[model samples]
Target: MVTRKLAAVAAALLTGTLSLTACSTGSSGGGSSDPGDSQLNKVLKAGELRVAVLPDFPPWAVQKADGSFEGYEIDIAHELADSLGVKLKLVSTDGDSRLPMLQSNRVDVNVSAWTSTNERAQTAGFTIPYDAHGAGVLFKKGADITSYQDLAGKSVSVARGSTNDTILTNDFPSAKPVRFDAISDVISAVKTGKVDAALESSYTVAQAAKSDPELEAISNPPLDPQLVSMGVLPGDQVWINYLNNFIRNLIASGEDNKLHEKWLGEPLASIVSVQGNAA
Candidate 1:
């Protein structure tokens, strides 16, 4: 009888212990002491911040000839890691992979010039705008295109899964979109005359025009001016808040402006508003 009683006691204690463990770990499965602090706590404990960036987007994020990354996004990742006192690991991703990486916990944040949209916000959290630019149309010089209306029945190229692609797909039904996996491919399509024009970030379009004499950006008002921000997997408010505060600090200290001038050779206001008031 005593043996059976002791066995029952042991089973009860084990069950109790497991319950406590599960509660302590919460749903994150990271064993976070505070359930709400999953990603933030994980990053702090791991001593590394994994960030997703687009490697082929020049003047933003690019993998150089030496297999190292440098650009505005890389610099911003460095700043984020420095503030967190953790090492930075840049995860090379294309536009289609950025949010997926975050959702899978493969990356803690996305610093890949992600534009904020209401549809995306349903699945991910976004910080205040650290950068902004409208979509610009890049076409061969002397092309008759002057506005979106001029592109009716014309083919436009854009990076797959990018905001530019979404804009082209939804807002410009009159134009056909040819999507590519990389920004380079999108531009190549236009340069090779495979497409009528390439719709891309205004900043990138301007850079492309500068390097190629035959390329020029349409003078029409930019399309779908987007506020670019850092993105994180939703449901982790703590991590989202931390990134939001980090961006606010950058703006308040004028570091964002410095980064703009350094890489883009222009002031912040030239591309986007300096309004950092959003929470």
Candidate 2:
């Protein structure tokens, strides 16, 4: 059922462009605030922190069958709310909805597995990256693919409007990208032999490989590292600064590494080092 829906969404995205609607309702947990109030002050006064998180991204954030969210980003959200002396309100989001939720004021911060890019920086303020990953291809174990160049003239799948989509569209023109609405769809397409391979985050590819012995992640001549960070609306230096400091504290106190180990089964990468400088 999900696959069929994703197929329709992908077709729409391919023919048209992705569209996001701002949420009409305010956050459910936070106290009401005047429209004119600053976001930082509003959250502080309301005693609730609304955080947007991806419900589908594993090891980062995932919604369980019981409707509860868990993973590294969920834990980080809890800590952020605690630091601010506010209750945490988790707002479920996806690749397309995460930024819109933040921009529409439906959430205070986006802790989704958001990678900081120059284009996104124009519209959103980002805390220093908490994690880093690179784009890679996930293919069947016996596939002949060994490098990025090997994908030329082949069909590859990617999540539409995602960093991987942009990478393939801009950097690898020879390969055809079968754009999907969700990463799960990309994985499904590859597993089912609907596409030759799938281009996505190395972490996601690794997780997929663990579940399916036939799948493997290839990073020979790795793509540019994507810096995963928390996002807020642009021009909020105060909030951005606070979030950055919070992230720094997480790293310095070793809590970040702990979460990484618990969820990813590995220590935090050195590339995700603490960035204490103000934004």
Candidate 3:
């Protein structure tokens, strides 16, 4: 029965776009909501909700060997499917490949940990953020670098197509930015001394530094961090609004922090300021 329901939802979502009004009734997330109330309804009706995920990003979204997904994003995606009243179908990909899944319509939506930026915004519409943290360069302990400008004419390695890449590419056009296939590889680049410094999300860098004592973090550059958002194909206000309210409700209900701990293993309080509209 659930399988049939997912099939139905897929048909409708694939048929065309859905208006926000058609999916959301401005109704509050009053309970353990079903995916039926918001833009998720379109997916539920289609009988299957195609969700893109990246397993390499721990504490955010990770794929398990048993075929189940682990991490905060996966937990929330499950909640999203529940709210939409459909089955949650997982589509796996890395950070660099997630956008392609969304663009090709191979997946209906991307719940993989996605950082929003002006460049990505042009390709995909974003919901409000679930997590926000700054990107910093990780160097060997006792390094002399103070800011992004200090890295001038030096080799900088970053995850391909990540927000850090967009920022460094646009901000420090003179710096040499090398693209690694994954965030982990970029992190490895720093430890391997393949690059002068490696740029990565603080969440990942902090985790890496905790386990390895040699990597030192440079706090100054791009003091502004990136906010992670749910990615959707453009023109789905119904889905967009649904996701926005879901995120807002996540913060309001305290589930946001709970999920953070569930996957990240600690409360990431430093990024709270980036959770909503900035001051």
The model with the greatest lDDT is: 1
**Candidate 1 lDDT, 47-142, residue by residue in tens:** 899999988887898898898999988998888887777798999988888766876779989999888889877666777778887888999998
* Candidate 3 local lDDT, 146-178, one digit each (tens): 676777887889888777887678877878998
Per-residue C-alpha lDDT of model 2 across residues 126-174, encoded as one tens digit per residue = 7788888778789998888988888898899998888989989888899
Candidate 1 global TM-score: 0.83
Best by TM-score: 1
- Local accuracy by lDDT, each model: 0.76, 0.75, 0.68
Q: Is candidate 1 or candidate 3 better by TM-score?
A: 1
RMSD of each: 11.5, 12.1, 7.6
Full ranking by TM-score: 1, 2, 3
Q: Model 3 Cα displacement at 224 (Å)?
A: 2.6
Q: Model 2 misses residue 83 by how many Å?
A: 1.3
Off by over 4 Å in 3: 1-42, 64-68, 219-222, 261-279
Candidate 1, residue 37: how far the Cα is off, in Å: 4.2
